[model samples]
Target: MELTERQKRIIQIVKENEPISADNIAKHLYLSKPTLRTDLTILTMTGILDARPKVGYFFAGQNFEPLLFEDLYEKSISEIMVPPVVIKKEATINDAVTMLFMHDVGTLYVTENQVLLGIISRKDLLRSTISNTSINKVPVAMIMTRMPNVVTLQEDERILDAGYKIIQHQIDSLPVISKDNPALVIGKVSKTVVLKHFIDEAMHLKK
Candidate 1:
């Protein structure tokens, strides 16, 4: 089970100011005492928190991120991968820049008919635009890190693989592809997306 945002906040409150009564926590969030009590019960029973006589709550365990990362290790990337933001191979660097802003993606795949071709990142576009005079006339093919050099993920891989690749390649995003057809781009995953999903899982619903 995962902890809700309010529940996490409650945990933080306890961590910051230990031995606080439940009423204080409830008042802080403007929640009723009984409602906060219910959450307290759930958290304590789950071993995420502990209580004592005359005292309130305290963090029971340590190294929460490792546990969260372990959970993320079991999850498939497909669960959180976003649809690949792609641009055509023939499009201009300016065109890629425009799409990058429109999609708000760190990286863009240059493709045709969903078939992977090349990739361009914000860094690549920025480098080219700043140095080149006719960026708009320059095809993305000229600036993109072409295939064979791109690091990609398949549907069979877990988010762990994506996370590893993100760190290993030191890139912002990984292009996700079909297991059956490695060239067929399916989606994309970033460290932010993976971490967000994992955090949500850790701090989930109360019930």
Candidate 2:
């Protein structure tokens, strides 16, 4: 709930003139009465102000963290990324499946010595099994979607970008890579990470 400058000023005005009417507050600030509607509602709901229908508005004896909902998606990917789960590129598709289930992650990176070779998901492994080729005999290298095609994020990219790319690519997870060496997989961010932000924001009520 990032309070606009006008909203903050409105709070200050209300604090100075307790039980002030909305029309007068707007007049004092030279703003249209209707323009203050949403601002007042937000301030009131967030516990920063109080109101009674006929009595007008008053300070709620509470303060809100003005930046609570500000630019959340603009946060950097490194801040939201979870540890990457990896398997050897040479490992069998069966091995990749085991690692996928073991970690309970939607996607896994195919790597050797921390360098990201490719990415594998349950869908990728599933598609392999349905093919004429024997999934158990197929190597992860053959089934995994290799880089140059894999959608990835850098450490400093915004988490919002992660969300956008996730929806754009229709993938479950994104690998966070180093800005200097794109091959180096540093971390990962999933839909769960983006969702956790919304959940925390909602649960983080109470001034």
Candidate 3:
């Protein structure tokens, strides 16, 4: 597809000062937010840019070095991970709701014997509620997504691979599984982490 002049200008803006907000681009270019949104959507669809919710847009298509940032981002999953708020297989749905609120995480991993059993997401809870099911009485396992179906990544994998998985799976995050125990989860790789690396690499390249 041929790039429009405005789209090219927007690409330059993101390339020059990425991890930059669309609203900021609108302001600097003196264009309305809707106009900028149209441009961003086109640029992103064309593979010249990538957008992250709450983070903004960044340039894509750059070659990257995983080893270079290994020391910076390759810490053991235990080091960088926010402790997963988990639910026992036998826990009540009410307990799942409470954990979600307590941790402010959209999904909760369900485990048995410290092994990942399944996952319960906000959507799962909502579906239960919408059906007028009694959360206090229903076990989380009843509504949770089962394992083997759950998508996961390992901490030892390069962050670039994690990013590729997210894009390929069309998932918001990937549970980081322990190498020693695939059933044991260590952390998560969300779009935020992916965009951070993309922005950091682009900035470094520009310098």
Candidate 4:
């Protein structure tokens, strides 16, 4: 449901003057009523404007947002990212496993203080357990994908760019870092989260 410039202007006009007739609306736009007939009909059909026999039209207050392609995918990372599940670099492998399950996340951001050090995934923990390592004593630092090697996203990057990076790197999640300091982890964006955003937006548009 993308709205044309004229359609948008029509909505604004109706909002300012409720129960305004097509003639007045056309007057506001300085156009003939016949020229605005299709726009008015489409607006009413989409529930954006209400029509009446005697009362010209009123803003319907429904579907106010325009669902353009850019509006859907050009949102910044800060708009959709979730808090990163963080664990200290010195935390034991067992502790990492606990954090992952506790948060129900696919990846955990490893940090020292507030600075991101690395990231550990479920596969890392599984491999450690299979190797007969002492999960309780072994530090997560031993297995985490270290910084400078880990792929990260900036907080201000577009969602479209985020999706592309995720697929290109074949990673499940990206640690969103601060633009001021690359080592500072601010949030996280995952494959699941991105998919959910698109799905939710699509469902909203259908409504």
Query: What would the per-residue lDDT of candidate 4 be over residues 1-207, giving only the tens digit for each residue?
Result: 467899889999999999899999999999999778767755764567889998789988887555444555678999999999999888999999988899899899999867999999888889988995689999999999998889999999988788778766778999999999887999999989988887777688679
lDDT of 3 by residue, 1-207 (tens): 245688778878888888888998887788988666545754664357888989988999633344434533444444444556677999998888888898777888898767888888888898887885688898988998898999887767765466456656667667788988898887776676556655665576569
Top candidate when judged by lDDT against the true structure: 4
Tens-place lDDT per residue, model 1, 79-185, is 88988888998899889999999988899999999999989999999999999999879999998898889999998798767766776678999999998899899
Let me know the TM-score candidate 1 reaches against the reference structure: 0.67
Q: Clash totals for all models, in order?
A: 3, 1, 0, 0
Model 1, poorest ten-residue lDDT window?
A: 62-71
lDDT, candidate 2, residue 195?
83
State the local distance difference test value for candidate 2: 0.82
Off by over 4 Å in 1: 1-70, 205-207
Arranged by lDDT with the best first, the candidates are 4, 2, 1, 3
Report clash pairs, candidate 2. 1-69
CA lDDT, every prediction?
0.81, 0.82, 0.72, 0.85
The reply for model 2, stretches above 4 Å from the true place, is: 1-66, 69-71
